[model samples]
Target: MKETAEAYLGRPVSKAVITVPAYFNDAQRQATKDAGRIAGLDVLRIINEPTAASLSYGMDRKEGLVAVFDLGGGTFDISILEISGGVFEVKATNGDTFLGGEDFDNALLQHLVDEFRKEQGIDLTKDRLALQRLREAAEKAKCELSSTSQTDINIPFITADATGAKHLSFTLTRSKFETLVNPLVERTRQPCKDCLRDAGISAKDITEVILVGGMSRMPKVQEVVQEIFGRQPSKNVNPDECVAMGAAIQGGVLRGDVKDILLLDVTPLSLGIETLGGVFTRLINRNTTIPTKKSQVFSTAADGQTQVGIKVLQGEREMAADNKLLGQFDLVGIPPAPRGMPQIEVTFDIDANGIVHVGAKDKATNKEQAITIQSSGGLSDSDIDRMVREAEQYAGKDKERKALIEARNDADTTMYSVERSLNEHKEKLPSDVVEAVQAAIADLKGSLEKDNLEEIREKISAASRHHSRLARPCLGKRAAAARLLLGGRPEEPRKRSMRRRSRGTYAESNSQVVVRVRCIKLFGPWEGQDHEIGVRHSCCLIAVTGIQSCTAVSIWAGVLH
Candidate 1:
């Protein structure tokens, strides 16, 4: 995708702001960053998808509380944000990573399968190909029913039984389709409610609601969003492209193309350390704006302890064992003291990219230990470095392989075009010419089987040469017809014009005189054909004669033809 973008823009793309679901965990976000690094991109920011969509809708410039409801193909997310003075701050975000349009499609697909089974007495779901067709038809009908009252799904010869082939046909109405997928649509409501509750606001506080993603285009989904938010979903932006537009807008800001717009995202989950007695301690709560830090002082669990283990964890669970353990480290070198006497200050810091850093400092001795939590789901630094090295090692071979594939594609295309032309104009050419063109086509086809790029290109050129020969006769006929259309006489050729200017100097002396000559010559059309033209030649010469010797020099000469 990076290469494709570069090809389209005719330049290298190095920096990008990627978007992920707001509910993506630390591991998931880190994995996304790792993917960008592997693709040779400097990932500027990993913004949430809903936030990006809000930006695309120009919510950054508006002053209000807005809800961005995003239901894409495979995931759903609800984000509540407050926009003021060009600063868009996310108040809260909630989502179901598994519920989305795919679920709706599957629900409709199951309905069709059940109906087919009841009528034909054969389970179409048992056949892979039939199931695939049903899935396609189900998705099409779902999209159609969004705009129309009803749609017909007909798959001829969907499957064959021992008796004979069977056809599947069904008409699904919008009401019935809604009935089948209403449960899936309702799953999105609780997330919105949770997001609103986390944001400390009710439905009335939201000034506007923005719908995003392909599934959000459904009328039923829109109705549900309106029912949940007490306002119709905003249609100010395209649901499918708003996320991408928001990303592009953010990229522009990073590139200094935009100004005065601030984007503040919240951490999806809480971050804290384990306290004494296996209890979870919250330093930074979930939905808190990031690039933030909090510190709390605790003491050693045992008497006269010199070291304290800082077990960092994330999640909303009250027990340390229930939450995810991010990383752990020990702050040592503390002066021995009784329990609850030594001051061990534990600080949790979350950066703008949602990466966590945990540190513990012994206030008594000024000793500190900190760890940057690495994502367990992503590659390590050494692994990324090794992969980058391997990519550089094989870069030339990859280019060569791509060139070979392109050469083969070009050869195949030329062969197809030439074969088509030969069949169309076979009567216009002599038998020998036709045969020669066919033989060239055969040679090109045979070269396609070999791995030699130069050989395939040579065959392609040869085939084009033969086809050009065969086309000459047809070209003459077209020319004659054009002449006949122009009152039985060929059209007058366009005139050619040339202009020239020159300047030089001659020196005179008692013993010697020198002359410098610079000439530029331009030629006109060749062989009385206006399209076949010649080129220009320029040369400079110097001649000198003295009392005792004579010298001549040719300084420069160039010819273009």
Candidate 2:
């Protein structure tokens, strides 16, 4: 992928933001980063694939809640997001990593194999070539069924019987295909409902629903999404490339080419530890926003227990034994206190990558221990360190390249802004100031054509200074106008009074002025209209009359004497 991107762009692509399954754990995420590094790309971030899909559809520019249903070749992911102010925040995400389009193909393949065996008395599943042929045919048929009512699955020389090679031909209809894979498509329904429930939103509340991944093109999958969400799924983004597009958008954001876009992802599962009585105690619940930290105080269950075992678990189960064990560590040197006396603060810190860091602190001793749970499985520290070192080896060159790109981007943006300002305010500025601004812009533009980053930066700075100098007069005019709109300026203090009123009835219209006024500005211009009012009569209303407008801009109101 890195090579292809670089080749297409005709440039060296050193940094990238890769998208992964929203439900991917730490190990899977790390493995992706590692792969990027191996390909000579600095992995800037690991974003959720569904979130990327949302970006592809430009959903961040819209408001309200959205759902991204992604069913890829080998996995399924559903993400519920709240979009506002160019921010896409994943409220909840859920998926089965092993379930996807491949499953449907497998289902069809099983049926075909069974029928072939029954018809020709030849079990071809054991033959690699025959099985591969059948699998490919099944995949093609599945895709064709999505668009048409029926398709033919035919393969000659599918396998050899005791006599010779045999041919397998079958007519697969859309209804039959749906029937075979309906269970697999239906599997996503509960997860969609669960994700919505976790997000505290109802199906009707979703303003837009996006479908991504190649499998989402399946008619059955689209029907399921529409049925569950009560609206036709949005096909605004290409099913196969939306995730990549989103990743590219993220890369642009990192490079400052894109602005005001934010992504807030969530942890896919609950993370906690085993407590006393073999129960699971959750610290960070599933679907909670990422880069979150929570600490809970735990105590020894037995008297004089100096050591405590902390077994970290992940899942939605109530019992520790039922959940997946992530990792475990022990806390020692507790000073032999009674059960529940020593305060052991177990802290769960899940970073933006959704990787968890578990820490235990003995309050009395101020000693702490921390462990990073490997979500992918038993990857040792050495393996990670090696990958880190390998990635760092390219850091120097990549850093220089990144600096050059940034300098160029900065130069281009500054030149554009300066040019625009020069055009907009040239009439208000001195002739020499405009000339200097134009000269600076020309110099900056010239520097952009060169390979010298330092020269480009210097020109950018000089151009910005010139632009600021030219903008001073226009800025001063704007400031003076703003002052005229507010109040001209403050003047000497003078006394004033404002009447108090109660209920609408005349009997209760008279009320005490219990508050004091310090200074007030009446509506409209106040070049010399400032006034300072002293405390009014305690129980009698004092109405401040006169002034041009009815509204008063009180700078200070306090208790009266």
lDDT of each: 0.77, 0.76
Query: Model 1 over residues 68-129: C-alpha lDDT tens digits?
Result: 99999999999999888888899999999899899999999999999988998888777765
Clash pairs, candidate 2, are 27-376, 494-532, 497-544, 498-544, 499-543
Per-residue CA lDDT of model 2 for 378-471, tens digit only, reads: 5565776676676679778788989999999778767755665466556778888988888999999898889898899899889977864653
Error of 1 at 376 (Å): 2.5
Candidates in order, TM-scores: namely: 0.68, 0.67
Q: How many residue pairs clash per model?
A: 0, 5
CA-RMSD of model 2 = 30.2
Model 2 poorest ten-residue lDDT run = 547-556
Candidate 1: segments with Cα more than 4 A from true spot:
304-307, 330-336, 392-561
Q: Which ten contiguous residues of candidate 1 have the minimum total lDDT? A: 544-553
lDDT of 1 at 283: 93
Cα-based lDDT at residue 319, candidate 1: 99
